[model samples]
Target: MKKIFVYGSLMSGLDTDGNMNGAKLVHADCRTLHKYAMYIYEDYPFIFEGRSNYQIKGELYEVPADVLKHLDAYEGDFYFRKLAEIECGEETVSAFVYFGRGHFFGMKEVKGGDYRAFRGKDGN
Candidate 1:
C-alpha cells in the first residue's frame, strides 16, 4: 500500500461512496506547506495550484497503488501527482499532492469556499 494525503473531494466523501472507497484512513491533521494554493477548478470541487504559504487541511490515507491510479485519473487533466510532506499528528509524513495544470496556469491565491466543511452525497 502507498501512503497519500487528500484535501479535496477525496477527503470529504464526495467520491468513493463515503467510505473512502477502499483506501485506509490513517488519520487526519492540519498541514501547512510552502508553494501551494487551493481552488475549485471549473466548480468541480477544489484542487491545489501554484506555490504559496497556504495550509490545506486534509486527511492521510493508506491506499493501494491501484487505488492511487484511480485517484490520479479522477483528478484528471488539471493535476499532477507529486510527493509532499504532511503533518500527521506528532509526526510529519510524506504523501502525494496533486498540482494543478494547463487551464490553471498562473493562479496564485486560495479561492472562496472549501471542501473540508462540505457535506451531502452530491459533494456540493
Candidate 2:
C-alpha cells in the first residue's frame, strides 16, 4: 500500500470539486508535521519546502500503487509528488506529498497551515 499526504483539494471531506473520487482510499487520518509552508495559489492551497515552525495539517491515506498515477493526473502538471515525513499521532510516517509548481508570488500564505480552517475563515 502506498501512503500519501493530501493537504488541499484532495483532503477528505473538503467540499471542493477537485477531490479524488472513486479512489479506494484507506487508513485515512488527520496528521500534522513540519518542514513546509502552504499558500493560497490562485484558488487553492499549494505547499512546498521553504518554511519552518508552522506545522502542516492534512490527511494521510493508504492507497494502491496505481492510485498514484490517477492522483498525478488529477493533480496535473501544476504539482509533482514527493516523499516527505509527517507526524501521525506519535509516530512519523513517510508519505507522498504534492508540491506545487505554479507561480505563487505575492499570494497570501496560509499561516495556520490547515486548509480547512483557512477556508472556513477566508472562504477559498
Candidate 3:
C-alpha cells in the first residue's frame, strides 16, 4: 500500500462518501503540506505553480495498487500524477500529486486557501 495526500474533494465525508468512499485513510493525525497554491478547474482540483509558507490541510490515505489505476483514470489527461514529498503528521511521506496541464491559466490564484473551498463543482 502507498500513502497519498488528499486536500480537496477526496477528504473524509465531504464528497465521494468520504476518504473511505474510494480510498482508505491510514493515518489519523496527518500533517498538511503548505507552500503550494490550489486551483479549481471545472469540477476537478489542481495545484498551481507558486510559493507560500502556509500549509494546505489534508489527510494521508493508504491506497491499494489497483485503486491507483482507477484514480489515474479519473484524473485523465488533464493531470499527470507525480511522486512528491508531503508532510504527514510530523514526518515527511512520499505521495502522488496531480499536475494540471495548464488548463486553468486564465483564472486568478485562490490566494492562501484550498481551491476547492472557493469554486463549486461546475468550476464557476
Clash counts per candidate, in order, are: 3, 0, 3
State the local distance difference test value for candidate 1.
0.65
Clashing pairs in 3: 13-18, 31-89, 34-55
lDDT of 1 at 109: 41
Candidate 2 runs further than 4 Å off: 16-19, 22-29, 121-124
**How much lDDT does each candidate structure score?**
0.65, 0.73, 0.62
For lDDT, candidate 2 versus 3, the one ahead is 2
Candidate 3, residues 1-124: lDDT per residue as tens digits?
Answer: 8777766666664554232455777664454454666666555666644556345656678888877777777668877777767776578888876666775655555555554456433222
Displacement of residue 41 (Cα, Å) in model 2 is: 2.0
Q: For model 2, how does the per-residue alpha-carbon lDDT over 1-124 read when each residue is reduced to its tens digit? A: 7888887767766655244554555444455566677788667788877767467887787767667788888788878888888887778888888887865577788887888788773323
Best by TM-score: 2
Clashing pairs in 1: 35-51, 35-52, 36-52
In candidate 1, clashing pairs total 3
Query: Model 3 lDDT vs. the true structure?
Result: 0.62
Candidate 1 ranges beyond 4 A from true positions: 15-19, 45-50, 103-114, 118-124
- For each candidate, C-alpha RMSD in Å? 4.0, 3.2, 4.5
Using lDDT as the measure, which candidate wins? 2
TM-score of 2: 0.81
